[model samples]
Target: MTASSSGALPQPRRFLRLLNFRDSLWLLAPIATLYGIFALIPFALIVRFAFADGGTHFATVLESRILVRVATNTVVISLMTTVVALVLGYILAAGLWRAGPKMQRVMLAFVMLPFWTAVLIKNFAWAALLQDNGLANTILQGLGLTNGPVTLLHNRLAVIIGMVHYVLPYAVFPIYSAMQAIDRKVERAARSLGAGTPSVIWFVILPLTLPGVYSAALLVFVVSVGFFITPVILGSPADMMIANLVNYYVRELVDFNAGAALALMILGAVVPLIVLQQSMGRGGRHGAH
Candidate 1:
């Protein structure tokens, strides 16, 4: 129909159309812009740097030994942290679950209290505790456990401890949330059917909570892989993570190319794990149906 032949649209209708379009754009704009600026741009930069040779290219930052060792350390540390956090968090979550609601809330608050403090502060606290003259060594010496001040700071142990402290809360909350979602009657029915505590846990509770455990493990691992401050504060040269290398390249060496490459490598490593998690989720959904 010709524009003139059609009845004139009401002002409210025209305004509503404009408002709807504006609202749609508004909904999308922040996410789109943020993805491009924060995620996409950095990722593109890192990919470009990864392939570029570090030396002679002046712009290139990828080095064979540096990349290999840093990547290895990063992966190892991340995996270790994930395992430790998952185990510890699971135990804590179990204990909390067993406790009454008031006690559970208290324990949960205690767990979450560390998160409210700054990460830097937490790392520094670790350093203080692990230092040669720190509490650990003093207690050891006081108990005649060692000859002298044990050098605990700036090592893999220190790094792992710091990371566990940082990521344990993340691990705890997800698993706890999953546990809370579980219906009490399900477990009660299993117990009522003569299933022992171990049987009920193994056959009922664990399977249902596998999704949360997997997700928590994945998230904690991913976060640990990109750890910078904890490693720098508590780790030695040998304990240097990929993220530390990235920061050194970007900040200390002022080599964006190498930094980008390292950062991209971090992203590349995490992407597969994320995909695997998603695939598992899809498979689980399909199986449920």
Candidate 2:
């Protein structure tokens, strides 16, 4: 009998490995504990507070004039952060893909350093660099690009800069994962057909990488929307995002109800986007063919 006819099959490289109540349920305990402690409990508390006083807090936030501006600032900054990070991250991912293995390891380390570093530290470092009489201004003055220290910190530009720095790695990895799955033969065939480097990149590589780009954009924007620290350290009062707004309500005003209401609202908007993005990501399979 042929091997194929013997009814034996090779195990898949990866699979679901469905769990049962008796055998495999315990495997989920650690994650279940962590999620329950951090996520589910906090979410439940927020729900309780949001519904207190019959949701008057929602009306309060909606009726406030600052809500319009805060929402606008949040959207604008998040979009700018996403766009800049996506462009720079695409360049970085492409370079990493083209590098030698040893060089790629070094490059990946460099890319992930910021990701490992705390958001506070990164924003503080940017603050130091962007401050008046700081290195950035000194360099600009030395180059005669500016007559004096420019206003770089506590502004929209600074916020975007810090945000882009924080979120760049998130953008890079998705695109890189997508690029890694691309068949090398596709590029080789295009080049063999007398396609130049730019033509090959534009016609072949770019199209293939679009799935990854979409994934990266969703990731970058989601992260950008949740930023509170960068905005506080590197941005102005007018630049506060949704998270900061929640802090303002809970911490400054000591109004947990309003904070919870706003928090739930953010959760409502973001959860749908996340669910949608995850569904889309499953379809892309990280851009694998």
Best by TM-score: 2
lDDT (Cα, tens digit) per residue for candidate 1, span 1-289: 2244255656877766866767757677779888999988977766666666644333344434576788789889889999999999999888887899899889988899778988899999999999999999999999998999988999999999999998888888778866777889989999999999999999988887788788789878877887888888999988888878878888998877767665665677689987876575445422442
lDDT per residue for candidate 2 within 1-289, as digits (tens), equals 1244345445532222422323466677789899999999998999999989896989977887787788889899999999999999999999999999999999999999998999999999999999998899999999999997899999999999999999999899888988888899989999999999999999988887888888889888888899998999999998989899999999999999999999888878888778767776678754454
lDDT value for model 2? 0.88
Candidate 2: misplaced stretches above 4 Å?
1-21, 285-289
CA displacement after TM-score superposition, residue 24 of candidate 1 (Å): 7.6
What's model 1's TM-score?
Answer: 0.81
- Taken over the whole model, the C-alpha lDDT of each candidate is 0.81, 0.88
After superposition, the stretches of candidate 1 with alpha carbons farther than 4 Å from their true spots are 1-15, 18-63, 275-289
lDDT for 120 (candidate 1): 96
In candidate 2, position 17 carries an lDDT of 42
Q: In model 1, state the lDDT of residue 58.
A: 33
In candidate 2, list every pair of residues with a backbone clash: none
